[model samples]
Target: MKKTILILLLHSSLSWAQMQPFPLQEVKLTAGVFKNAQEVDLKYMLALNPDKLLAPYLIDSDLPLKAERYGNWESSGLDGHIGGHYLSALAMMYASTGNPEMKSRLEYMVSELARCQAKNGNGYVGGIPNGKVFWERIHKGDIDGSTFGLNNTWVPLYNIHKLFAGLRDAYQIAGNQEAKNILIGLGDWFLELIKPLSNEQVQQVLRTEHGGMNEVFADLYIITNESKYLAAAQRLSHQSILKPLLAKEDKLTGLHANTQIPKVIGFEKIAKLTNNADWSGAAQYFWQNVTQTRSVAFGGNSFREHFNPIDDFNKMLVSNQGPETCNSFNMLRLSMALFLDKNDVSYLDFYERTLYNHILSSQHPEKGGFVYFTPIRPNHYRVYSQPETSMWCCVGSGLENHTKYGELIYSHTHNDVFVNLFIPSELNWQEKGIQIIQNTNFPYINTTELVMKLPKNQSFSLNIRYPKWAESAKVTVNGKIQKINKKPSEYISLDRKWRNGDKISIEFGMKTRLEYLPDGSNWAAFVRGPIVLAAKTSTEDLRGLFADDSRMGHETKGKLFPINKAYALVDESGNYLSKLKPIDNLNFTLDSLHLQPFFDLHDARYQMYFQTFTKEEYEKQKDIQKQTEEALMALEARTVDKINCGEQQPEVDHNYIGEQSNSGYDEEQFWRNTRSFISYQLLNKDQRGTYIEISSLDDFKTENLEITINGISIEVFSNNSKTIRLKLPKAEQISLKIRVMSNYTTPRFTEIRIISNE
Candidate 1:
């Protein structure tokens, strides 16, 4: 008996269900695809030395450290971040697995963090480098911030939000009462610190990435039932980002992908709690645009950590850095929030697809390593993060990803249960006195069986999801066929009295199909019942298969195969997906190439999108591809190091600094220049380069340009030549600082490369 309520939501009248999910503790994953992933993740978590993870927090508290800090991002400015992520992972694992060891770990982490907060006295705990000084400046209304920096500090607010989220998870998921107190105190401290800031100043500070600060504040309100926390959440929402989103415009191109997803998640969370339908609609619009236009076939978005233009996938196809793992992690969260509000199976469909392909495939099957990017570039590989050596953001999210599969497998209300994913797991409905066990091999085997254990005869509803990819499906009760016609992407609901020992079986018709890019490109991905399939290319030159502690360790710095060499499907008369011949067990073969589930087709170069062309198209494209590759290869052969301007990590790693300068995306290209000046430190390591090659947009706004290498000015021509090469004066050190300047406006410089003397 459900009643509907109408809400005026963002240019539409909508009605939604009051559906909510069962607690994570109530859902237990016992066996199958998720369990294996969980075990691997647990082993990796235990392998990490907790003392090292806690070092930064201890240091910030003016306390003695137990161990040296972990390297990479951990030892760098963004310390203590992995520690925060670790706490959440432990809490989720404890709740899902009933693992006493995980519970103990959670307790230990919370206690340590609590001690730090107690020492601070004002209830602040963090590992951001010189975080106290930065916040003090902010408290004094002396804020100087940018998209990635605050008062010359690296994302201090973002770093602290990790602590906020961890503490919240510790209390909400693991029931750590002490964690709740610390979290609330910290929240209060934040309120006091920002009480003096004007809304404009707050927005200025929020120019940097602050991961889900608003969402965590709303969660605090939920836990404490305090209106002040909700108000605080509203104050924390960045208006600049939210304003465009609320207006239902797409201003997301060129923005950092993961940085924006969390903010929108906060918007949706606040909307649900306060019934702010406009904000909810904004979040919905963002999700639709990203998943539909920006995202690739694996349900992941972004290239090289930034959103490439929707109309062009050239950057996505050429770069070894593709859709990041952390972006998909947050997208799943956004999807879950929307699904609960409207009870939409489409959201669940996306959740299932991304979970299976991206999140499930993020970790190595045997090594227990985590992947940063799943490159769609043909013949390009991926780098995996080792437990001790890598502390990249993806590693932090990867630790939590596998531990929480039980979260969306099954959800329930007071009288109805919804089995969302066909993973083998169990649900403990303690309130209703029922225990249910689901057993299935899932995508490999199209059948699933559910058995119920009840103390007595019970009346409730069982809603099983019928995925959008299923061609046909059937259900039976205790071996008796229950004839019910249901369409794709709808739920098959059975409402009746059920006694103990009742059994239910479901069988789905699995079929293969082709998914194309949103831009209507010739490239296409193969999908069999929502599982993305890939063909193994060659394993040669799989450099950096496992990441090191270097600044750029997460990237796969191997040679990119020329696009002209890619295998093409020449069949123009029919659909290539249907033409594939089936092999054994979710495996297929097309034109001598064997394809298997992407999650299983790792450890080697693989192709997710096979180039398909008609006879005429193939002939025309082949020569053009070869010509372009030859020119690109010629430039690459003599390059010692290169930087792509306006990209975050590359610029930061190269020590970029500027004033009166701006960067943006235009015509599918990212460029950086300045009204005053902009600069970067280009490495000429091994003394290999005597020339600095700068490529800019053909359009120039200024007649005269000033350029310098290592503080020495060089004469430059003010012409329309897109590529300019300047000879480097003799230098002993391997690094040189290069600056480009204009009195009024500078040309849009795209790439800066240090070329070899040869």
Candidate 2:
């Protein structure tokens, strides 16, 4: 029966003529950086207590508790999210390495979840806090959602989507039949829950970050050959996001980056399964815009969790938030889906770049902690999560990022094999009766050799990618060079009969180049092949290197170093590459700095981007930058507590709650406005702050708004000024509220700061 089910899945998967990635069980990671990362991730996964992760599910099901729920995000509104990610990581790791511990843990988790579902009595199982009540509200059409919350709960749909994805991965990747049953049960529950809602109401619910609901439902349809699951997938795909992409419009600016990327992945999945050309085109357009116009050299996008203006990346360069790990995690997923669907080698370029630079560098090599942010602001550091304390969204994605490095190393069709990345690995293509051993020390060594071991002579094509960054790529068979000229972003196919001892080798030359920001800014990053290079600047003042359980512990809270103090390339000859002297194949020396692969640099402040200028422009630019940095530092010294109004993490950290409120970005600043009321609770830190300041992007009429402190009305000192300052009460914690006096919406508040008079 198991073999029959596998055959059926394979038949259904080939309904579309797309490249398919080999199962993780077939591609084994050899000795390399990726293998080391996998081992480290496994250790971190073992460090987490399963009972703590399962506590919320048990509590929701009214089962006897074995352990307390984990703190941080687990105890916070987003309870049980990491447990879902843990399920995926365990399944993939078990498939990749066949580790007995991983399989045992996976089976344990699935069984416990099965128990939870049975106890719920409605085929429902989730770790979301008060999930029963939350879904009931949605079932009754009592929907209210923002960018990160739904029905007064913190992204309960997104939280539950993780479980759905986990169960799907468990069944599909690890061959757990029980997990599949649970997934279908949950899917049916969701289908019935939204049966009474209108299309408009579903779209309203999609406003929150719900992960890839459409993609999971589509997987369910593929698994069961059911029509309802397909319809549910279509209904869950947010039309507001899809319409703009379908029309080839980039309405992505100012939107949350990670939330939209997963939806596009779902778009590609549905397009492939149903053969929808328009949706396929929309997904392609989105991938092009994000990769070509919005991404940094490291292949990560966004600033402060929102997509910044494509024409200007200055805000991203200056802010400590930089590109988030979750954005890159989802981008890689979208890239892989598009690459398989279109057989495009260009998509592999981004997948390889992000895998090497961002994903590989996100985890600590020895400490086994996961990074939330990879800051590009020169001299700024990143904070990694502790297994027991940290539970951020990035932590959830980071846990799975390193466990699946073997996913896209190679892809294939019926009679052809495609080498997508240069990572060292061994592939056993069971259906094709072939085994290939790929050996390389890639990025450090510029050549990879593959040896074929087959039962007999086989006639098939071996397609190897010619990377966009590799110059003068060469392919050789059994030490004999083959003349096949191809440009970058294309594949060179070797079509012939292959024997047991046949060998194929690929060699390429890498040249260092200065890649400027996508915004065409003066700032530049160093890249050689697909590897991003950086220099460690300082070891001092690396505060919060390992995160605690605090709400904002994932962010680097150290003092910001002045931008003018960072190293720059000031050359009058318009030749910046001349400054870099090669120390070795993967290391370089630039004046007093030693640069190496970004994945190798850790535990210190580093600079990935450096400002470039001519000799004549350096001094003047330095002075301007110094003044701006000084003013920003002074404000930090005066601020007791502050919140960026429309940003997701900041608002969520401050316990934001509102009704009839909306948030957006304008003039490169985030703002929130409301017709009803919006409130946030901020800390004053020992009653040192005497004044509360509210700043808006637009002028506001004082007569049309009511400002309150702790439910007490406060007088605004400025009538129509962009800045409003009011006296604060003598309390350490202040509840700030802004409401419209009549029917008019309040001004777009950009920031709220607690000020100290001293």
Candidate 3:
């Protein structure tokens, strides 16, 4: 058994790496269309002060720190997370651009982190608040783990995992030998921290959001070729999420979207390394479920960071918090993993769609700000994060997102080089002494020309991706038309002995199409090939266009325009795309509305999806929408603060605390109730609020429910039998607690709101 395991580990690293696409360092993005965005992202990366980001590390190391910690989440408990992400971003940017500044930044961060680890006098290194004590508690089996917080610490595992990933990237991508040493030490520390805990206890700790600790462990195993790291990776796997996935079950609905994506990426990595078909199949199933059923046209899913029902997207259409940038960031990682595993063009198709629509569109093109959410709520705008102000998860992912655009453009396996995306870039295959330069206007011109420069005559196969969106294509080798035979979403292979200055160009025209919501709703988004087209609405009242250093800075506090006010595409035959008029440079015109690429529409109110109806159907729906919008707007006007019960992040953000409580969703409604007691701190920004409204699907006649505000009981009487409103004795900020004192289970609490009297 020992010999077999040893041989497997020795061979696993080689086989596992072959299964991966070419490293970002090997493929260099040239000066082209993507260069500007890359430069802007570089500016954003360099603009952030590393000293402030490294403060928590300095404090942890007992070293003197000069800069105050950045505000928002950076000052909050999730400290040093940005520093971790900065390491990865700097490493990747340095590799991609060969920039001295980026290399210096990466080196500085690694040195500071090493100093911190050395000062600790243990292998452990993290910026979690009193992180040593926190790990000590978990080491002693004194764990109180929740989905968001563990041992009363705010996602300490998740926070630490960022550093783990950063160090790995630093060693693997940036070729820093010292980083490898530091990373191994930290990995050893983690192993010892959990050495005393039983498997059951380790699983208990895994219940919290750990941000792909297993993935990093698997990566560590690959790096060191050691069995202990692989065993630790297995021990760290979250069974609750993994078991159902292994059985090919879709148990992802109503869960935090970003939390699960990284875990699945890890699962796929482990699967490839161990040749575990079940694990591989589980990751494949998850990818299909998310991309096909859950994700919107922009290739993003979830509402306010939590997945809603797959069969229903009504919440997505109404909520200002739409798809999170972090989710797409992780999804792209998973997509790239799957693509490498099977060489599947389908994964690349989704990857291209998401890369252009969500990831590229996430950043502020000129000002270099990162966006957390890309709201699909008709005319709702998005908030951009400044370097010092916003330390949100999206900000961390956003930093790394733009730095690695050269990653998937071209992937090679031995002698075969695969052209995946249409992005203008260059690749240097030093092993083969070959340099490939691909240039194109892309979606504007629909043609990309690849010029290969080889040191000598080289025998290699060039595989060009025939994307799912291309209707027909023409291939030319050195200006001579070649016999082309390939289907949509398949790669066209050209195997030959290639010499220097060989030019191959592909011309494939894009067609306009309309994609409906996953739930089969009437609302639809337009697509030109992989690019999503959006209509520019009024830019009025775009509050927080740039985010401030506030707790909820990432959220766009702008007014939401009613969905009914959005222009509808009135086409009974569903041939709306056929009637569209093409403007210049990937722009189109439909029904007096000029539509452009969603990625190009920035800092303005835009509509990604439009409700489609025939002339006759529109007349019938118009009156109903108007009536519904009026009521909703009136209620929103009075709402001071609101809580969507059963949702994880919102409840946590609202400072939710409970005993003997559980949460679930049913019939498109999420509810939270407790046999003992549950409470949320509701904010009354002003003392003008006169009442508290609690909406539940409870029958008050059958169940005895007691509700209180700050230890004072409030009388609840049903006025219309649908909702019960408690007239507040005084309007002030208070914790509202609901207790089921009787034997019956408390009714499902759907919503709790503080409303100001008109």
What local distance difference test score does each model get? 0.84, 0.89, 0.85
Best by TM-score: 2
* Model 2 misplacement above 4 A: 1-17, 718-720
Span of ten consecutive residues with least summed lDDT in model 3: 1-10
Give lDDT tens digits, candidate 3, residues 340-380. Answer: 77757789889999999999999999988999988889988
Misplaced by over 4 Å in model 3 are: 1-10, 13-20, 674-679, 697-724, 727-732, 737-748
lDDT per residue (tens digit) for residues 653-673 in model 2: 998999888888788788998
What are the per-residue Cα lDDT tens digits for candidate 1 across 1-758? 25353533222233434567778888888777678889999999989988899889998889898889999989777899999899999999888888898998888888888888999999788887776787788999987555676665667788888889999999988899999998999999999999999998988888778899999998988888888998988888888778998899999999989989999999988887777889999999999999999998889999989998888888898888899999999999999998877678789888999999999889998788999989998888888999889999899999999989988888876578888999888888888888899989988989999999999999998988988998898999999887777788888988889988899999999888888888788888898898999999999898899998987899987788887798787767755666688996589988778999998877899988977887888899999999998988777878888888877777767767765556677767778766666677776777778777788875643346667777777654434478777777666343433344334677788888888857
User: What's model 3's lDDT at 544?
Assistant: 91
Candidates ranked by TM-score, best first?
A: 2, 1, 3
The true-structure Cα RMSD of candidate 1 reads 3.0
The lowest-lDDT stretch of 10 consecutive residues in candidate 1 is 7-16
Alpha-carbon TM-score of each model against the true structure: 0.95, 0.97, 0.94
The number of the candidate with the highest lDDT is: 2
